[model samples]
Target: MSDTLGAAVIGLGMMGERHAQLWAELPRTRLVAVYDIVPERAQAVADAHGCLAASSLDEALAADGVDIVSVCTDDQSHLQPCLAAADAGKHVLVEKPLAITTADCDAIIAACERADVKLMTGHVCRFDPRYVACHDAVAAGEVGDVVQVFARRNNILASGLRIGPRTSVAYFLGVHEIDLICWITGARVTRVHAEGTSKALASIGADDSILSLIRLEGDAVGCIETCWIIPEGSANSLDARLEVVGTEGRVAARVGGEPFEAASASRSSRPDIVYWTEVHGRVAGALRDQLEHFADCVLDDTEPIVTPAQARHAVQVAEAIHHSLDTGAPVDL
Candidate 1:
């Protein structure tokens, strides 16, 4: 690879466009090619970034001078593009929920290992400033031995469609808190008790709300509440609250309206949502930071921040949550 890494972005949706924009501006990366199932989307992004728009994944994979690939496609379609990148001897940075299933995640991990390629998942919360500050505070014992945690993610109907009806709230929003709780406390989830209900948007076959309680390895417990019941034309939003009650004292971080205000409102307003402010601005910055970190890891042969094994654990927890909902019983990990 040259001093500037030649990067290709697969999938030109919201996430993909962010990646493309970041690569265009990143000093260490160059946008060589972009591939999307939708040609117009691909061309629009590519033209804006001054990059080639590949007609197919194979073309993107075979494009000359490409050394890194960002797999920004949907959750279910992550495997093939990642495997192709690994086979093509390119480093890969895949978006989160590594895959829809554990088996598929395993295959991608195995292929990357066998091919000696670096693979990093897009658990961007690990890089978020607020989350980073909270993690540091907890690690420094500012929160003492975290005994309990409460987290929530809620949004309006428009934002809910991003995850789609086929996927559960646990995988889409809960996964971030799962990773956060684990990362902050440095513990593995031992068991999960969960329940879900859908009073709205029944057309998508998705739960309108979900609540889960997780027991960690050290007996510390965490709770997650996720809902997609915010009405249409409402502000797009993601509200999260983290309260860590420890042996000494408690520390909490919140990113939404106050409880009283939230209670008064029918649903969260858009003012709370902060992920995609300038379309490609924040997310693109995070994606660039993540991919650059992965590139450094590949160059230095170091372990990635979020390893495949960790991603697998996230998926396992998600599965456990789903199982708990189905069996109406706490599922042991």
Candidate 2:
């Protein structure tokens, strides 16, 4: 067995809690501490896991024997904690949509490089069993030379409970599909055109849904549709579909099944049936596997599967989509 690495998780939200749980269970990791702006939440997780709850970022960084830090905070909040962890000489795993902007991601990468720390972004879908299988099939030329792709991720508003209106669907929902598309095809996005609407979530000051079309450098075309306006009680769904048209043949799979059902009520509202559990839970195994991989990289002195630079490119693509929507024109990357 590898030596246990003491780890700290910042941000005790749903993702943070999940990371703590996984760290507790992973034989190579020990959850030494947890930190959250909300002291109570951090304390709760620490207590449950027999660890400490650092009251501040400095305390967490200064804690003795912490070798790894996991940043599970909001997109905007990732920069500082990540920098501090790197400066403290700890390997860092940051949750994805690296940051709200490319500049922020660059800064985090610079900090990690300066500190000589291993930095891995949380593009956990690459570790997912289904996504892994799909990637393998594509690698074996099951799809031949890829030609076109389509992917979608949708969920009820319940999953949005912690996410505020300020968060865009492109960043929160679209980033996953964006990363997956690029990973599956091994091509760079060259141009993007997007449109978004906020009929139900206008009050939240964010477009609740988005549709995007992207042109890849290799002439492969892709589309992504994401939303969070489904009713509260409706099943939370993460619908992902990928179709790879190659010169010789084609391969495809739906990440989750779509089920149709009817509900009768006086008001008679029809809700879309949700197909996935919590978005995080649907990908929990992936998250755990990714963390283990990060640990292995640290132990073996190997590069991470998802580098900060690649993560920055994903952010760039997402930003391009946002720009495309705002300008009503295709944005070239």
Candidate 3:
């Protein structure tokens, strides 16, 4: 192992591409290989990054100098690649909600544990400065005796059309808030009652929106609103916010309401500046910070910021949400 860790990324979707690019761009890691279900996609990314286009997951993990693997596959398909990466003795960084099911999350976590390698689930919001600042304030006792939390993560109609069929909006978007609420408040979700409605994505047999009322371990309550039916013409593709109210004070963080905007004759847009954005020809923002954090953790042999257990908790809550939606009753964890 040199000073820099070598990286491999499986899956070549939008998020996967970003992972590959960041691995190539970051100082502590360099892209060594990339693999995708589609050979052409893998080849394209490898060509652009000057890395190996692995023909299979085995090849990607076996590539010379590959020390870390980024499992950027879809919500449901995370288990296999993650297990393979761990078995190959490489560190793993997977995208959230970790997996659509708690069982899969556990399998991945166990595999990494057995292999004695680090595992991190990419709950990118934790790396966001605003979210981090909010968490810090809460931890510092600025928010005394948290009583309630409210989170909203709404995306454009295009997102629903693109991802609704593959997975529900709750796992795709709601999990971020689920994890954040528990992390910021330092309480586990004890119960969840959820309801969903579908119209725009009904044709695809997917819910257009889901609202969940959650009770934390200390009787703290939370409301989570996740919808993917916002019009694409909206200035931002994503609109998200989180607020924590306590007996002494309240802390809140807002996303998608960025001050910077660009307008042409046809439309105006607010590009994401916090999550994944280009600055001076390189990837910058929370996602980059997240990747760097994982690399540094692996290099230093320290625990990742987003532990496997914490990530699994988010998946467990998501499963409970779906169960509540199915039974039309509250599901106690």
All models, RMSD in angstroms: 3.7, 4.1, 0.7
* Predicted structure 1: lDDT: 0.81
**By TM-score, how accurate is candidate 1?**
0.90
Among the numbered candidates, top lDDT falls to: 3
Superior by TM-score: candidate 1 or candidate 2:
1
Model 3 C-alpha lDDT per residue in residues 94-117, reported as the tens digit of each score: 998798888898899999999999
Worst 10-residue lDDT window for candidate 3 reads 300-309
Deviation from truth (RMSD, Å), model 3: 0.7
Model 2 lDDT tens row, 143-255: 77788888887766755544645578788878888888888888878999999887777666777788999988679898888887766555324556767777767766665
TM-score of each: 0.90, 0.90, 0.99
Per-candidate count of clashing residue pairs (backbone under 3 Å) = 1, 1, 0
Over 93-177, each residue of candidate 1 has an lDDT whose tens digit, in order, gives: 9988888788888999988888888888889878766677888888898877778988887776776665755577888777788
Better of 1 and 3 by lDDT: 3
What residue pairs clash in candidate 1, if any at all?
A: 235-270
lDDT rank, highest first?
3, 1, 2
Native-referenced Cα lDDT, model 2: 0.80
lDDT of 2 at 207: 77
Model 1, position 294: C-alpha lDDT score: 75
Ranking by TM-score: 3, 1, 2
Q: Pick the candidate with the highest TM-score.
A: 3
- Residue 333's lDDT within candidate 3 is 95
